[model samples]
Every structure is written in C-alpha cells, then in structure tokens.
Target: MSKRMLALACALALLLTACNESARPQPSEGAAEIWFAVGTGEDGGPLVDGGGAVAPEYRALPDEADPVEERMAALLSGPQSAELRSPFPSGVRLRSWRLEEGVLRLDLSEAYGGLSGVDLTIADYCIVLTLCQVEGVEAVDITVEGETVPYRGRKLMREGDVVLSGGEGEPVAITASLYFLRRSGGLASESREVLVTENDTLATAVMGALMAGPRDQEELYLPLPEGTELLSAAVEAGVCYVNFSRAFTEGAPQSREEAARLLYAVVDTLCSLDQVEAVHLLVEGESLDRYGGVPTRNPLEKDYEMAGEEKPAAASGS
Candidate 1:
C-alpha cells in the first residue's frame, strides 16, 4: 500500500478509538482519603492517624479549598473521647486557611495565642500536619490578625513536624451557651466548655450533646428526659430538622413555662449554626404538631420573648 494511504488509515483508526473512549460511561466520585493529626499517646504530642470524608466528591484525591472549613470544624471539635486530646486550646478558631503553590497559610483568631510553650508548639504542628495531609500542601505559615508570628522556633512548619505531645496535659475545650432552668424562676444560659466528640453532623451532634444532660455538679439543668435519643438531625434552607425518640415526649415537662424553656433550648442551640436560622422538632423522623405549647406545625424561629433576648447574628462561615 502507498504511504499516503497507510497514513490516512492510521488517522481514521485513531479518531475512531478516541470517540469510543469518550463514549464510555464515567464512574461516580468516591470518598476522599484524609487524615487528622490528633494528640495521642501519653505525651499529648502531635500524632496523626487515618480519617477520611464520606462526601462523594472527596472519594478520591481532593483540592485544598474543597473542604478546608469542614476539616477545621473537626479539628476544633476535638478528638474522640478515647483519642488523645486536641492540640488547640478553647476559643481558638481558624479564621481562614488557603494554599498557594506548596505553602498553606492560616489566619487564626486572637484565641490562637491562648497556648504557650510545648502546648503552643504542638498546636502549630497539628495545623501543619493536618493540612499537609492534603496532596498538594507541603509547608504551613500562620498569621494572627494579618501579622506573621513565630512557631516552633521557626516561622515555617512542614508536613513531618507532627510529634507526640509530651508531659501531662489536658485536652482543648470549646464552650456552648446551653439554656437551662433558673432555680429561682425562668430561663437562663450558661457557658460550658468540654473536649467534644462529634460523630455526626454538627446539628445532630449539638442535639446529642444536649440529651447527654448536665455533668455532675454542673449548675445548669438539662431538662430533656432520659432515654431520649437524637434519631437524626439535618439543617437545610436555614432550618434544622431534629428527629427524636419517643422518650423526648414521655420525659418532657408539662407546665407551660418549663415546656417553653425546654423547647427553646433546642431551638436556640440549633440556630447557632450558620446554616440554621430556624428549626423543626420531630419525633421518630416525623414532625410534631405540638410538643411544648409552642406551635410546632411550622418551622420555629428564635422566640426572643422566651429566649430572653434576640439572637446576635451570622456569617463567620468560620
């Protein structure tokens, strides 16, 4: 065959192959592999073990900005009860984090400085190690309120900096404004901080924590009845849907004043979430018409009258 004819045939074959490949079906994305640097071992030193995302888009490798906030949320929430304590201190928040080229820059709130000495160094390593888990990030630089600061004797921290926390140390704690009955009369709120273990969505975790009730000697009250379980919870379109077990109704307060206070506790706590501006209480996965004399048929917003004050505000996608 002529060289011209051979060349034309090869070109035609290549085009057909390309078309066939393009026509093949594509697979759905799976959960991405991720790791969270935890303070484990006796020393409370920075250590990391496997953790990952179930979100479909993250099934495989992921981009830096894709879920930086979610990871930050997990970090701030503290490790599981059995895991080593959180490296960060209470009140600290990652204002924002970004990656450019190979460097990851973190802008932290003033609360980030609450730690000092070995604890402070471990906290910095935790941030660097946790973020470096991302495929592209290799180094970390942190700033407080836009000003650069020193960390671990150097301004730059890298992926391998994580080490076991040493010496006797306690875990980080985060506070929440929980509403409870005032021994004298009406509704009131108190700030309580603990090393939280969040196993599900933030909305559900908040509800679950509430149901656990107050700890020993805690001045606050947890009015929710015993055996009540957070079947499931989700926040969408600015409303939190909380489905509770039957124990919720059985253990609920009958008096109007106490009932309103109890209901508002769930409402106010959920509304604290950025996505939840209101809430719908449910039992066994279905909405209830009424539970505490407050109208439940409709999605409920904060009752400033019962809450004792109006909610403050929003944004802080932090």
Candidate 2:
C-alpha cells in the first residue's frame, strides 16, 4: 500500500481500539467506598450538622485478611482526594478494635480524648458511617484510650442516627408538653415546640428541654439543677433509660418535697410519649436506688396526679 493509505488505516485502527477500551466494564472487584468529612463547600451531608459534614470516596479495600480492620486503616490513612479530610485528629490512631453481637468497638489513641462537643460527635459518626458498611457491624462504640467518655450524649452510634441526606434533611419539630415544678407546689405542663435532628431522639430532646428550665422561670421551678448533663437517653421495651452525670445527684434538692418534684418532673415528661411506659433514672449509668425520698431501683411509672393542683405524696416514705 502507499504511505498515505497506510497512515489512514493506522489511524482508523487506533480509533476502534479506543472505542473498545471505553466500552469495557470498569473493575470493581476487591474494592469498597469509605466516607470522609467534607473539608470545604456547603455541607448538608450525614452527621450532626453544626458545620460538621462528611462525603464519600471510592477506594480499593486492602487484601481481605480482616475486612473491618483493613477498612478502618484506610479511613485512618486519610482520603486520597483533596476535597475530603479524615475527621480523626492528628496522631489519633486506632489503639484497639473488636466486634461483638453486631457492635463494633473502636478504641483510639489518647489524642482523640481531647475532642468534645460537636467535634467529638462528628469524629464519632465519621467512623460509624465508614465502618458500619462491613458485615455484622450494626453499631459503633468509640472510646478514647479504652474508656468511654463520661459526658458523651450518646454511647452507641448507629447508621440510622445520621444519614446521607445530601443537604435535604430537615429538622423534626415537636411541641412536647414538658413538665416543670409549679412555684406553689405541684407540676405543670408547658407546651413548647423543640426541633430534633436524626441524631437526637424525642426522649433526648424532651430531657434537654427540661434541663434548660421552663421559659417562664418566675412561675415555674426548674427541677434539674444547672450544669446537669443528660449523658444519654433511649427507650427500650417500654422503658426510657435516662442517664445523667454525677452533677445531677450532687445538685439535687435536699428537701424531700423538692426532690420528689425533681424526680417526677423527669418521669412525667418522658412518659408523656407513647413509646415510654415508665422512666428509669440513672446517675452516671448506675441505677439510683433512691433519689432523696423517691424509690427508683426499678423503672417508675408516671403519676397522672403528680401534676395535679396538689403534689402527690412522695413515691417512697422517708
């Protein structure tokens, strides 16, 4: 063939080869995607939004010796892309990890112990969302240097707790009838609408509102003392477990009447919800046998009359 004809044939052959390569299926074997916190840009992604948002990146899973461990290492190594960043702070390597009964417990180095508030929350859910993709990991329990944070609002982080809403998730607004002590004596209800996110349950929102005290402080008495933290709150099998920090007990009222009001304020507020048949009060996760004059060894059912015109007698006799 002539030189011109040979050149044209070679160009046509190259175009065909390029088209064939483009048509071939992309390889996805031995690979999985992991999430990372968004470093910049408008973030409405999963995780508790207070400027803490996350996005995902596709990466190859290391040789499948231990899938969970491998995936966690990949997350710790940081995202390959420039737009994403690891939520874990510097030097926060995984100290230990174990899976039991669908719960994945990850103990990170002491560097992680310094995080609190929104930063801690974001870092936690970042690990949760990334690791939960592995089989048998229904929830994540993260600790710093082998100990749970005493003041953490939630101990168990689940996939459902945060979602990839892509900036569309809206806060749920509920008008809860929160109970507070009446200045004169008995308890009274205040209907206030509070916004709750996917990360917060209705019980938690109500408990937080009660802790914030009533809007009309002059007419109502705040049962929960100031600086009391709601460690965690959840309902299981018709019982709402409300865990508070030690500050709750230390700041409790000394008078029996005042104490009873404080205890029942929490009980009645939680029981108002249909899912909670009774309330179980705990100070730092230990069941309180008695808080002042109230017997709380077992979950206490709500007292319909506690909020009546007159305060009912204490649940337990002094």
Candidate 3:
C-alpha cells in the first residue's frame, strides 16, 4: 500500500479501534440484498430513470466472513442479472473498511476514482443504500485510495437523501428576495418573482437568479461574475451549502470591494430564506481559506451592514 493509503488505514483503525464490537451489526445467516446500477429495461432497452438508477439482487453471505466486507465485495464483483451492471470500474478493489458508531467508511483502490457526476452518484449510493440495510449502519462514507472524491455531491451519504421517481409538481410563481451589488458599492435586495418546480429548491432558485446577474444591469451590478454557475445548493440545519462551478473563481472580481460584495450578496440572499441562517460557499466543490481578500474559512452569517446604502467594509483582521 502507498503511504497515503497506509496513513488512511491507520486513521480508520484508530477511529474504530475503541468502538464496541457489540454495537456493530453482525451479518445475517441468509441471503442479503446487494444493489447494482439498473442498466437496461426488461425488453433489453436502456433505462431512462436518470443515470443514478439502481436495482437490487440477493446474494448469500458467507457464514464465517465479515458481512460489510462481503457486501462490498459482491457489489464490486458486478451483477449476475443481465439487466444490471456494476458501477465500479473493472480494476477497483476494496482495500479496507471500518465501522464506528453508525458510520461505515470504505477505502477502495485507485480505479474507483474514475467515477464522477451522475455515474459517481449512482456508484456511491449503490454502496450506501446496500450497506445501510445492515443493522448498525446508518450512513456510508467512501474514499478512493483513501482520498475523498473532490467533486462528489456529499461527504457522508444517508438513505432517503435521494428518491428515484418521475413525478414533478407544476411550476409555482413565488417572489424571492435576491441580493445584488449596488452601482456605487455594497449590496441591495431585489424582490423578483421566480417560478419553482418540483425539481427546484427556493435556495437554488435564488442562486440561479444571482448567477444570471441582475436583469437591470445598469441599475444594479452583478455580484457574481459573468459565466458563473451554481452547481448545487442545499440547507442543513441553518447553514446553506452553496457549491459553484470553476467559472466562479475564474471570472471572480479582482477588487476587494467587489469581492466582498460578491461574497455577501450570496450570503445575504440565501439568508433571506426562512430555513437558511448562514451560507457556506465552495468553488468546484472544494473549500477555500480565502476568496481573494475575503476570509471564507467558516460559514458566514448575513451581514446586514454590508447591505444597502452602506459602502463595503474594510477587510477583517481576523
């Protein structure tokens, strides 16, 4: 094993070493259901349930083997049914696994890193939904060769986080209070009516509008740079985690005043939502210690002082 892999193994061991064995669920004696990506329909045609589609097949657990390990191995081994397929690449192997509390962490060989986007999502949840069936497991955290996939949607995935269905509600018109840069400086709220469909979240809709820039460009400045796109946005607790594409940084404002405005415009806009009290921003799914001269090491609360007639504040010493 490489040094990185060895380090990860040692860390995993240390984390789980003191865990009570009795707390971990033992493998059942009979067949256990293992999940696989749904490749085709019964008629030998392609599936159109979006790329994260999956189905399950039952396989017996070895009497004397580790249940979690066995389940992972079966998943990596691919499916026996003709209509199902393995989400893992051919060469990927499960190197190590450990369970602590209710979280199961699995470290796989390098080949697993090849999956991304919807393919990665399907592969990940295939493991998650499969293992979550075990008595003690409530969530699954996966790493490829001991390193987290940089752009994967979430760090720890739990069941019910995703639902595979075909129904979408009609678009309903709702007004969102979005923040945009003032022509002179600082930020101001713009109340606009936005349509939200079943696929849209209010936070996401607000973000999309922010990224689209202000409709009246002459009156208000676009805080987010041209070409910026919102990758994902969701609220957990009171913090809204917002992930943006690479264009956000590439086209970012160079001036400190504009950067501060850009950062808080997102923060204040999302905070306007009832569920979100703060904003955690990310570029290309990775956290940054600083965005230009702005400190982004923590989730930022809505700074009312940065809004309206007020000018952008000076850089913080902390």
Candidate 4:
C-alpha cells in the first residue's frame, strides 16, 4: 500500500476511537442517590433486601471550637447574673465583642442614653473597670449598632473625662463640661483643664470650684444665672472681694438656691487657701446683693433671699 493511503487509514481509525469514547455514559454532577434494602425473612441467614447493597454511613468531622467567646461570656456574665446592667438610668446594652489590635471592640445596643456633662466622668470609670478585668482585654473600643461610639471632644475609645491613676497612686480629681459628636459613633467626651493643687484632697476642692463656675472662664466663680468673668481677688476691710465682668448679668439662669450653691462652691474653694476669712461678690468692682437668703458661712446652706428685694438679672454670655 502507498504511504499516503496508510496515513489516511490511521487517521480514520483515530477519529472512530474518539467518537466511541465521547458516546459512552458519564456520571452526573448532582449528589448520589441513596438506596435502602427491605428484609426478606425467607433467606433465614439474616435478611435479604430487594436492593443489591446498602448506602455507606456519612460521618462529618467535628467543627472547630471557639474559646474566646466562651471565656468572655463567662467573664462578663457573672455566675450570679446573666445580663449586665448600667449604674445610670440610661439603659445601655452590650451586644457583641471582638479582639483586634490588642483592643476589644464591644458592640452595644442603641438604647444607651449617654450620661450628661457631670455624669460622664463617673460613667467612664464604670466601663473601664468592668471591661479591663477580662483576660486579654487591656483597652476597649465601644461600638453602638455596628458603628464606633461618638464623642463631643475627642476619640471615645481611648479618651474620657476621668484620668486614671498614675502607677500605684490614687486617681486625681478633675472636672470639665462634656459634649457629644453624633457623627463620631461611640460616646461623649470632654477636654478638661488640670488645676495644680497641694494634694489629692485639695485637687478635689479645686475641681468642685471649676464645676460650679462658668464654662468660658476658669478663674471666676459666680451664681448660676450670672455670666460674670472673675477678674481678680483682693483682701480689704477683712473681706475677700471677687471682681468680675459686667457681662455677668446679661441673662443668667438659676434659682435663689442654685445661686447660693455657686457662692458656696467658690467660698469653700477660696477658704481652702490660708488667710482668707470672708468672700464678697463684686461685679465690675462694685458690691452686689447677697445670694440666696443669708451671708456665706461654714457648711454653706442655700437659703439666701434678699429682704424685700427683686429677682437678680440674667446671664448673656454664651
């Protein structure tokens, strides 16, 4: 035979083989169908079934274990109680937790009505003490409804009002007005001015003075309704005169008792300094009517009322 004829015959043989292979039956991609056998007592050996064979047993491997969640749950939910309750009236709920970057991200419910300016410092202490006790959690990032909690002044996760104690010493006392940033997504925070005092006890005395004073200025202490800026302090005629700005009486707000409390907060703070026997309120270098009903004294009470006197002016400063 010619070489060309032999090559054509070989090509035809290869084509036939390919066609035959393609036409053969193939397995379906779907799951295998299961079959069961029925007993036929006639065999008497054990029991014969109509089917040829039985299906193989399916045993799935065990799932991976999660120790973090279990441990955290045990730590947070004490053996006595299951749900954690807030000390404040606001009903805050803790939802989920995740550890990342050496910090615990605690997801909370939306029901958390944040604490106000004065209450914020106390709230921070509560949250930090509770979460820090858990193992492997040194810091926390609070999230509400899947977003980071927002603060008014700074980052909520790491910053707060109350300053932690340095090393082994007691925590120092400080006070500041708290604000919240809704867009931030965590909690309200505040920036405070640190007042240097003689000791821890005296530091608290200074904080009390700041809390009772106006938001804009730190030096002057005035009645709640008064917007007075404390200019200077002088001792004359056995009285410590506190000179203040005339803007003090534009549109201040406070009852007679509230005004008296402000007076006492100032007097108490000043009295802590040696050689100050009495304090006198002065606006723009002029003496003002008494606050509440009586003159300030030790353990000052809020009963100051003028004799046949009219209501005081308001504060205008923002």
Best by TM-score: 1
Tens-place lDDT digits, model 1, residues 1-318:
443322221220100011122332243554332332232332211122321111001123244546666666666776553434566545678888788898888898876654432345446655664567666888988888777753335677775543222122222223444456655555555444433231244455556445545554345576777766667777665677888889988888878677777888888766654345688898988778887788798888866566566543433655
Candidate 3 whole-model C-alpha lDDT, 0 to 1: 0.66
- Candidate 1 ranges beyond 4 A from true positions: 1-172, 215-219, 310-318
Write the residue-wise lDDT of candidate 3 on 104-203 in tens digits: 9999887777554335656776788789988898888999888998656568988765443323432333344568888877777765544434334445
**Positional deviation of 74 in candidate 1, in angstroms?**
24
**Could you arrange the candidates by lDDT from highest to lowest?**
2, 3, 1, 4
Question: Which digits, one per residue and each the tens of the lDDT, describe model 4 over residues 84-174?
Answer: 2223333355678788765777666664334322233334444544445445766766666886434323334342333432223222333
lDDT of each: 0.54, 0.66, 0.66, 0.37
Candidate 2 C-alpha lDDT tens digits along 1-318 = 543322221210100011122332244765666767655322112222233245556677656468777788888899887756677657778888889999999888877775543345556766877788888999999888889975365789888876333233344332456688999988887765444444444456567666666888899977666567778777777788999999889988988889988899989878765446799899999998898688999999877787773333333432
Query: Which of candidates 2 and 3 is the stronger one according to TM-score?
Result: 2
Against the hidden reference, what TM-scores do the models get?
A: 0.45, 0.45, 0.44, 0.34
RMSD of each predicted structure: 19.9, 22.8, 18.6, 34.2
